[model samples]
Target: MKTLNSYLSETVINMKPSGIRKFFDLAANMEGVISLGVGEPDFVTPWNVREACILSLEQGFTSYTANAGLYELREKISEYLFKRFDLQYDPAEEIIVTVGASQAIDIAFRSIINSGDEVLIIEPCFVSYAPLVTLAGGKPVSVSTFGEEEFKVNPEILEKYITSKTKAIMICTPNNPTGTVLSKKELEAVAQIAKRYDLLVVADEIYAELCYEDEYVSMPSIEGMKERTILISGFSKGFAMTGWRLGYIAADRVFARAMLKVHQYSIMCAPTMAQYAALEALENDEDVLYMRKSYQRRRNYIVQSLNEAGLFCHMPGGAFYAFPSIKSTGLSSEEFAERLLLEEKVAVVPGNVFGQSGEGYIRCSYASSMEQLQEAMKRIKRFVQSL
Candidate 1:
């Protein structure tokens, strides 16, 4: 009889289990748990967007779309990018709708990374980049950023890790876990490094519309970087459409075509109804604005409350999370998270899950209601005092 693990791919065998999953499993079984663990938005998809998707189904638009996604959705995405970021791409040949930004990352890695290539990933980062790079036969090299820096990726950090074998760099802003958004100056610096090294860039800007302080900056918007950058974004974060499972990547025609081939083999197209819903979202900007304002309010409340509770937290410029330092409690991030869940009934993610740079921090998502945020903060304060 074959062993249960015998059939696993070597890469799969070597991969660590997701650090986010264990806490979620514990949170699921506990009664009355107030969870700030997940990075999902609490708002429902705007009625107009949902109605458009239903309309499509009613009109018998359930068939599989083109491998590159529907032409109309792609065109809308192109227009949206131009209007928001001043970035331009030909819809027909430069964009491919994906299952989500998650799939776009996978496709990007598969398309460019050959065996033994190195991909630079900024940490603490979104969890999937390293695993996906490994699956594509590339090594993930992490560059650590600090909370004091607002987790911005510095040029020196990029320069330190880049080598001849480096194939691509993955950057996310506003960043998950830290809620750090890169400034134009920072992005230009990154662009310079990319140009100097002749490196491809995978910019994940799913949280672009959720910025609270300044405007979102895109690597592609910098002069001369658009051709070398693959812009990955989706409606999930901005439009409160996480369940829609729709995303897209925009790049030069050459890279876009290569990604399309991988996308065709893996996921023929993004969900048909989701593509239609996302198209409607692009046409309507008001919904995104409303959600953005709501998240900003939540961000402010959580940051202020955590600071008052003796936990040091930097006010995030974007995204719906606050990464507060828990070092004063004399507990590791994992221990603090575990005790907070068991004793205070509040669920948060341990920062160490993102990378070693995340140690001594815990990520709290404020996507829940204000009342929930208030109660969670009170519990957290009580827990800290007890410690």
Candidate 2:
């Protein structure tokens, strides 16, 4: 008899496990490990949001919703987008709530990507983008941004990666790992390129609410980009509702319909109770703002501490992460991360897992409590000094 692994799809069999989760698993088994590995918020979901879900359950509103998700939740998402980012979409026709932004991303690629088509992905991006593209039977082409550029995507360099096979460009901001938020001008430039190439733009703005610098620029708000841009976001990061697993996609009707078809077959609809919880989250911006402020403070302290310890970290403009260069310690990214965890009981993700361009750094999420962050920093400082 052949091995069970032989029966697995070649695509699934060959895919590498997530690099972020490796450290997370390592830290999980070890006691006294101050882990900054995962990007989840240390904050709990706000009381009112949880209360709304509990209320829904008590009311016995636990049946399946529309395949496109609750219309009211879609409307609230539409309103929130317009109110916060000046982006507009039709609640009934242009949005589909899915099981977190991860699902939104999956369906978006599956709907548009044909076998052998290419999607231009900016690195160091979330690990899922490339794999999802591959699973969709599309090639994920890397358009790497450097630290010297503050990890901001450059349109000229982006255009260099385009070819007849190229079908779409996927971008995230405020970005994961790097925390670099693109300016409106930068987005406009990429918009022009997308329009010129007649390519789709899958904009992952999951961390939009956490932006700390100049105004957050929604890609769909860019002129002529809305029709081509598929906006993926959720309550996971900014709303402190990671476990709620509620996210939505906003796109033109043509794209929305196609993606809805894929989502209906795969997920049916997002969780019914989570929709109620997300509705409450949308109504309560104050809680999200409070969390953002706390993350910003943590960001400031972590960046400062990393620089002081001679790790040469850039001050991230958004998100709750610090990508500090570990090159000075004369260790590879994985070596640095493993040694830091083993020797100092501090856990962080190595940058090389994100992409080749990330080889010299490590990503430290500052979403933990201030006390935890302070202690982690002290341990990190001592480790670096010893190096």
Candidate 3:
């Protein structure tokens, strides 16, 4: 009989579990532990979107959709993309509904990467990017961005990483861990470099609508990037629809067709009820604005609170996370996080888990209520003083 390790493929054996979820699991067994570790939004899915799903279920709409998804849902996603970002996706051929933005990300990598292709990844970035690129038979090369630059990738530095083997670059704006949003000027530079290199771009814009100080720009909207960009987004963050697991990919026909082939075998289709709910979500921008405003206030509160408590954090222009430096605490990020959770009963993710550049920092999600934030701040302050 073969052992379990013997049966596992090298790729599956090599992948590390997500660091964010690890702390969350530890915090769960403890009572009254206030957590800021997970990236999920705190808000409930809007009532109208939930109602649409319930209605669809009541009407017995329970079957697999066309491999691409419901034509109407795709049509609405196309219209929404055009109106919001000036993107034109041909709903029928250019859009494919996905399980969540996560799956869309995975298949996007798989569709484009040939074995040993190098994918330039901007760090410190989302944890999944490297693992996903590895799974796609590609190597992930880190391109570091600094805190002084507000975590935006500099184009001049980006030029140094390119080689003939580099096939694509993955970008996330309104980024996780650090909440930086790329400006139009930054994107223009990136677009020019990508155009010069003839590389594909996977722009993860899941937090596009959550921008606070500046309006978010879609990468595909930049000149010369339309045909070569694979855009991934979802109803998770902006719509508070995490459990719905509905997302989409918008690419030109060639890439979309290839990705759909993977989706057909791996997922078949997104849930039928979730599609109706997402259709309803597209009709209600008011709900999104409401959540964004609330989050912005919480962002203001947490950033200020963390700084006042002796942690230095830059002003994150978007997303609900506050990436604060813990250097003064004289502890490694893992030591800081583990001690804080055990001592203060406040949970957060260590920054180094995001990438090597993330050492000496921690990511605190302010998506929780003001009450939880208040308590979490107090506990963290006491913990720091004790050390």
Worst 10 residues of 2 by lDDT: 284-293
Give the TM-score comparing model 3 with the true structure, all chains together. Answer: 0.98
The C-alpha local distance difference test score for the whole of candidate 3 amounts to 0.92
**lDDT tens digits by residue: candidate 3, 139-201:** 999998887787888999999999999999999998988998999999898889999989999
**TM-score of every candidate relative to the true structure:** 0.99, 0.99, 0.98
Order of all candidates by lDDT, from best down to worst? 2, 3, 1
Best by lDDT: 2
Per-residue lDDT tens digits for candidate 1, residues 264-329, read 998888899989888888887697888888888888899999999999999898989999999989
lDDT of each: 0.92, 0.94, 0.92
Cα lDDT over the full model 2: 0.94
* Pairs that clash in candidate 3: none
- Which digits, one per residue and each the tens of the lDDT, describe model 2 over residues 333-379? 99999999999999999999998889999999999989999999999
